[model samples]
Target chain A: MISSIFPSKNFFCLNKLSVCSDSFHLNTSLFYNEYSVILTFLFIATILSVIIILFSYILAVQNPETEKLSTYECGFEPYEDARHTFDVKFYLVAILFIVFDIETMFLIPWTNVLGQLDLVGFWSMIDFMFELSIGYVYIYCIGALDIH
Target chain B: MIVLIICIVLKILVVVVPLLISVAYFTIAERKIMGIIQRRKGPNVIGFLGLLQPLADGLKLFVKETIFPSNSNIIIFLIAPMLTFILSLIGWAVLPLSKQIVLSDLNIGVLYLFATSSLSVYGIIMAGWSSNSKYPFLGALRSAAQMISYEVSIGFIIINVCICAGSFNLSFIVLAQNNVWFVVPLLPMFFIFCVSMLAETNRHPFDLPEAEAELVSGYNVEYSAMTFALFFLGEYANMLLMSAFVSILFLGGWLPLVNLFPFNYLPGSLWFSLKLVLGVIFFIVTRATLPRYRYDQLMYIGWKSFLPLSLGYLLLSVGILISFNWLPT
Candidate 1:
């Protein structure tokens, strides 16, 4: 019964676990082999990027005047060098933005696998999050992220 | 095929979910650690010690206006973070947390990891170039240089591991260390690996690219809200990957210090998790303790210090193996 379910190849030995006896030979013969997966992803990414570029170009209205091309931050005339000495506040905000933003991305996958993980995964995540919160609070207290 | 699909799904479920949650909290952990180190109280508001802060922050970003600079190449700007985020996530596919638990237990797992990590630089460069901002561009350039520089040493270190273990498979590497962790025999290589990890992940003392005082927000300066968040996620995820790599490579991943009662019965994945958590704590501690290094200082440490040390260690390991008749005689 187990053999019927799992087939001839043993799960423990991954090299022999594939459906075909000569899996490597089959893999070599296939046009899109396992090795090509990364390349395929790269190719897809490139194609998507090109498509986005073309789409943006078609939609964008380019009035390429000097001032228009220049940096515009809340319509302030390019006052001070772009490399002007800015307060650490700007950086703090940027760091905070990055830090918390990453935390949110994790919630989705965690929620999905919560059932299988049981309390172990849950407590681990909580502990992990708690440590992260400490960093946030530290940064906040140090005025790392404070704009004021 | 059905079984294969089930295995693949299981791998994804195991790797991706934990990865995301870990990345999220890594940020919070960084902040909190930095807070404690500086002798200040970290986030205590927003749901009992700022427990709900990450959620609230995510919501705020989701609703925030995404501003595109007029001169920026908007498409690349948008895609760059996504690229970084995706690439970061892919490395976990090859990382074997335990005996039977990995997303894609490829034969060339180490090579796959190296390849993906190298590819991540493209995202950083694209983010910088597309922003059309000098700071972002400079940051991107710095990142490109730094990543390439350290990557060589990192690759060499991994090669040394491969030589010692005689396998490219991560699980095999972990299994090879069953008798003794690599940290004992390959102490120098282990040290180099740790430092290389710091450089590879662009953590403090080596984070020249994102040096706030100099490069502003680095490559993603123009990025706002969730887009910015993606880069953030990618960075933290990369950090987690590095930490996990360190744990598995040197710390005898999932191998308890002493096989006590519950520890003996505990799942291998649990041990892997414990090691990972400890690794994350180390990351936080480093961030808390170390100040950012100067750009030249960062480069000096990588090239002058880590590179030579790792190469020397590799030679030492080779010599030891040869002397012991451990080489395929």
Candidate 2:
């Protein structure tokens, strides 16, 4: 079954995961080779979890009662439905996280190339951080992240 | 082709089996250590020192009744724990047991870990929303906000580590610490990283999601039997994963302590295990030691404190490296 799909062309060295170091003048193929093992890991993990969950589904005793299955909120009879309008602060925090998180993402490539780039690169990243701090300052003063 | 498939399966089993076993033992280890700290015996009767307790617990969960909330969205509810467990397992793929023994030393090993940990936000969100219960819903909300907040700081710390290493590869990150581990020079970042790791795993001082006093066991409040067990397993697995991450980034993954005669003689894999064990003990000790943080204080620490501290540290190190020409090639 597996043989037909993989057509045996120098299978991943049975000994080691393909080294995709930055030093390797990386082509796209080498990158794919590095990722092949992860696909296997994911497949095996999904299958294993499914089988385990299904096993419990099958072998487990079935004894569902009325109140036992009801949504629990401190054993009271219950109030209205679970969903209700709550604080908008969580939403605000999440929105701000997205903006700052993207700025964090931009720093990754900047950091990776830092050693190779000259003093200009360092100053450029410093400038970027300065702008980000300004945004942070604005958010702080506006009380966007304040709980009170 | 069959051989290749077999090899991959064997590789997965090698890492996964031991990992699952350790996660199992780690539960007992946690109980035993916490017991000693609090002055009592923990789980000693189950097996030779509670060694067989996890296996027994697994069997018990397998045969127990799984309760489905009548008011829940059944599909997403069922999928949540599965997602959590799967996310935890997949992160192990890129962790280098030793330099030669990683399952996948992907170029983006650091980001792969980060991304998977980030995706775990969904499992909690799904479980909370789908359970259709008030407590779980509240738990989920708290969890999402908390996770997203800490992750920002963690991302900065990781960026600093990656910059220091000059590569995102986990192996390269480990090897970069050959002369002096990051913990020594990057000491403050190391501390912040540890604190964030605790928050990231949703453990002590920051376990706001599962805060029993208010949230009533939190998102898994309504979950029972094997479904509940999946959440438990996933959480422990994540702790193990975070501990391993700390070792790789700061303590020097698979590096023996002090390259002198006695320490250098030990194999790299053994050194890695020792460091990983130390990390797990750190988790347990912190759990035993600290009380939970106030939710508002938690948010304050994540944003106002760790974020700027890490950001400043990032620029400080970057400036130092560039000025001194100390950057790794």
Q: DockQ values for all predictions?
A: 0.04, 0.42
Displacement of residue B107 (Cα, Å) in model 2 is 1.2
Residues A29-146 of candidate 1: C-alpha lDDT, one tens digit per residue = 3323344444444444445334433444444443455564456444566454444344453344344434543543343233223333434554665566567657755754664422
Interface quality of candidate 1 as DockQ: 0.04
| lDDT scores in order | 0.66, 0.87
After superposition, the stretches of candidate 2 with alpha carbons farther than 4 Å from their true spots are: A1-28
Task: Put down candidate 2 lDDT per residue, B41-71, tens digits, no spaces.
Answer: 9888887888898899999889988889998
Docking class of 1: incorrect
Q: At residue B34, what lDDT does model 1 achieve?
A: 81
Strongest candidate by DockQ: 2
Residues B124-171, candidate 1, lDDT per residue (tens digit)? Answer: 989887877777877877777667667756766776676666665688
Model 2: residue B101 alpha-carbon error in angstroms: 0.8
